[model samples]
Target: MEGLELTAFQIISAVGTARSCYIEAIQEAKKGNYEAAEQLIKDGDEAFVEGHDAHSGLLQKEAAGEGEHIGLLILHAEDQLMSAEGFKTIALEFIDVYKRFDAEKKEA
Candidate 1:
């Protein structure tokens, strides 16, 4: 595969992994494993950032007039990027709600 294709694949892989981490974070919270959930969220953010950086590199290349041709793979990578971002947001909210529930239980 070409360099661009390889880069796109890497971005998709990283972001998809991040997405999974974020989802697992929510699941862990449901199981009352707050610490594990928090750690997963942190891991997810790290993976997402790496993917974002790779994606940004393509954007910079395009801006510099060394445009990378568009393909379905690249579009898919963007989809994964957006999905990861959305998952991260939802995961954070879920964690907060879980924390509140835990607090309530403690008060009881």
Candidate 2:
């Protein structure tokens, strides 16, 4: 973990954690814990930013004609980043649905 390997792993770990947080947030919302769910979403956003920043470095290098050495690890890292992004959207939607359910229950 000294160069591309290091950056790639960092991206993978950060985004992976973000993805978990997003999923957990949805679970929390389902449990009617809106506060905790919101906090998890915030945490996930922070982790996502870190991963995106790391990936940006690689993009910058490529833009400068010094693209990443191109390896399976890096590709996997990119995949994780995309997955995390998708999870964020899904989590938000799930949370909203949960909130609506809670509201309806209260009204009932």
Clashes of 2: 0
Per-residue CA lDDT of model 2 for 1-101, tens digit only, reads: 59899999999999999999999999999999999999999999999999999999999998999885899999999999999999999999999999998
- Tell me the tens digit of each residue's lDDT in model 1 across 1-108: 868899899999999999999999999999999999999999998999999999999999999999867999899999999999999999999999999999999999
Clashing pairs in 2: none
Scored against the true structure, residue 57 in model 1 reaches a CA lDDT of 93
Give the candidate number with the greatest TM-score: 2
Clashing pairs in 1: none
TM-score of 1: 0.95
lDDT of each: 0.94, 0.96
Error of 2 at 74 (Å): 0.6
Q: Which stretches of candidate 2 lie over 4 Å from their true place?
A: none
